[model samples]
Target: MSDVDVIVIGSGPQGLAAATSLACEGLTVLVLEKADHLGGAVVSAEATLPGFVHDLYAMSMNLFVGSAFYEKHRVELQENGLEFVVSAHPYASAFPDGTSLKVSTDEGDTLKMWRAHSSADAEGWQRLGQLYDDFTQVYFPVYSSPLPSKSIASAFRGLWKVRATTPPAQLLQLVLSSTRSFGDRYFTTPEAKSLAAAWGMHLDFAPDIASGALFPLLELYGNMRSGMSIVKGGAGKLPAAMARMIEVRGGEVRVGAEVVQIQTDGRKATGVQLSNGEVIRAQRGILTTTPLPNLVNSLLSKQSVPSKMAEAARTYGFGPGTFMIHLALKGPIPWLDQELSDVCYVHLAPYVDDLARTYQQAVAGILPDEPLVVVGQPSVIDPSRVPNPNQHTAWLEVRAVPSEILGDAGGDLSEISWDEARDIFAERIIDKIERYAPGFREQILAQVAFSPVDLERVNPNLVGGDSVSGSHHQQQLFGFRPSWSLNRYATPVNGLFIAGAGTWPGAGVNCVSGPLAAERLLRDTHPSKRAFRRSR
Candidate 1:
């Protein structure tokens, strides 16, 4: 007999959501994760010092909170131990000239902040706020939803729903021409454009890409509506809440129980073989987080997946690898601009070309001479980060490190040890931060760094250390994600399916993959339930 109704692998945001959705249907479910603790990428820890909880990866859950998930489950989750803290100021960014901009919760206050830089920008800033306000109420939902096809047709229709309220010509220009240069258009000054550009580049190495112009709208909306939010304990707390919810419904979570192989019998997968010589049968086989090509090449029998599907999986491209630095600072970073004092989010890229070059270097195997860095000072938003009053920890996401930089030898110069590579990357990043925050380097109490190689070491699903699982380019979106025909999460194997950030609405803390997989599983399982009733 089958072991359970469904089994979800990984306890990332996606996995937890899948478990929760399936559990709600009264299906017996199990979730397995390799990490000792739950929450894959969204984890928190005392990496810096005791009592000072540091967000392991991302500090902001504004996107998740602004989403329908929070709207529907906020009260339910809070009762189950989920709590969040929102900061008044979302972000602060500094240019080389010693000027900085801070985004405040109040629109007028934010406009005043911009007014200090440019009078015209004060008006432009107001327009920008309106854009995000409209977006929060409209555009974001469409992108977050399981709307079929991210086609221009879908985009335009989504736009039409809000078009009557927005300035048609301006909105159309922003949507279609957002790629030309977010900083060059709209505001006459670089300060305004760069501030706006900050929102666009969060899509992990977006650079100066064309289609991303609309992304700034998301950033603006997030900052305006919720500011950056810190889960009560840490980023991991969010996933932990989801896991708890699932468990409360009688679901099980297994950690360090890796599924090494799919036990298939010629045409269908009957169960999964664990690395430790045990097998778990799946009466209703489903994988809430499976990397297709990796599965086809390693776990599944060659005959199971069609040659074309295998080819597609092999050809599917994941975006650039993510390199991060976690630091336990000796003291808070002293900033030149007082406005940056309470800032939670900071981006370090002066010119658009410099930012694009970071991506170019990353794609090519070269460590950026000067990388575009994303720094999150969660302690500023959540004072409970560290035990020491004077000291706090910070996380920096350097988007410029190449995937090959961690290897012994692949390209330029010679191969270096992982330790050496991490140290070298950390030194360079700290030096860059010192440029803006002059005494920053001196404040380092302790620091740890992770290259794409280090990220891959932790989660194989994050192939080559890519955070997005796969790229969301026009060619890879929707049905084309992982593979076109395999869009429903079902594989050629009868009971097996694929799920993860590698699927549609590619990557993020969003539960799109999990809920979508659960929905498909529910639909597929209904037939079996009816047949079982007939048999009885």
Candidate 2:
């Protein structure tokens, strides 16, 4: 008998979700994590100062809350010490001129905010809201289902059911439109346009990139409908709860277990060899949640997979880098528009033109003069993150930074290394925020910044700090993700599967890939299903 039914490599959300599913289904599972801590990007720490908790990466639980995994295991996870706090004000945007716009769960409040900017844009927002209601009926099902599967086919059939309500042309446009095009088509005012377009940057989608409109639409409207959620204490709590759940179900999660090689016999994966030289065996299969590069290049032998599949994995593109600044604050961010304090996230990219410029500059290896800043105010939503009620924390995300410092667009830090320029760039980001929120710098009790290089050091899955793991560009999305050959979450190596932010429905707190991958493995390994297939 093998050591375990399945050996999950990586303790990220995806891996944990898969292991949890398998464990609950009566399969023995062992999760191996290289790092001492679980929750790859979903970790929390007192990074800046003692007693001030900050989410290291991926603070938003909105997507995870809406996920199928959560739908199935919400009660068990909650019972296992998982608690979520919802924010009524999901997101907002702060402009250079001290004006800001916010999206609220209340439709009337959101409409009033839009109308204050432009009546025509308000009407456009209303129409978009209607479209969102109709489009999600088709989109969500397809998004949650596996690409090129019977479930996805069933999801497509939903399109036919909703065609009378939502025209096929509109859906096509949503799939193909750029953020700039989508914004221009929907809203006339710069404020309204920027509010939606800035979200594109969160997914490495520049304003002008084709097929970039979908994410912005989804984020803007999705938050408006369901608000936002954060783990009760910190992001780390969710993964800890998952680990506990797995343990209670008789599965094991081992940290500091670095899987250096996947030991295979013929074309079948047998187990993994740790860096320490210990080999752990899996009876049924192995699931890897590591990035695609590590999966194909570092873990597996070149001869194990087809040449084309290996090349595709080798050439899998990671998008622009992300810079993070975690600030321990004496008090709340002193926003010029105080309304921003109540919201979960405040985007600091002022205009669509600025977003396009920053994205282009980063892609071309230049530091942006004005990078898009995503200001996350977790304390406002949940005060337990701080030591005292008067204290606060600010999670600042600076997007579209170059992985390698080639040149600074501002021309100052061109010669300096990221190690040398991290603080300087962080100050530039703080200054940008200060322009919108005066005295913002004064509230900072302590600050810790991570450059693109630092993020990669923290989580190799981040590659060059492309936090979304890999780009979600049209060619790399849907069934074409990672590659056309391995998009179904299975490897050319039988019984070895891959799933992560690098795979389908890429990125975010959306925990779709894990459970979907587990379902596939279960179906493939089921005795009844196998017998039926052989009979056919």
lDDT by residue for model 2 (236-337), tens: 999999999899989999999899999889858999899988988987899999877878888987778678778887779999999999999999888999
Clashes of each: 5, 0
Best by lDDT: 2
**Alpha carbon lDDT of each predicted model:** 0.72, 0.89
For candidate 1, write residues 240-262 as lDDT tens digits: 78877888888888788887777
lDDT of candidate model 1 versus the reference: 0.72
RMSD versus native structure for model 2 = 1.7
Lowest lDDT sum, 10 consecutive residues, model 1, at 406-415
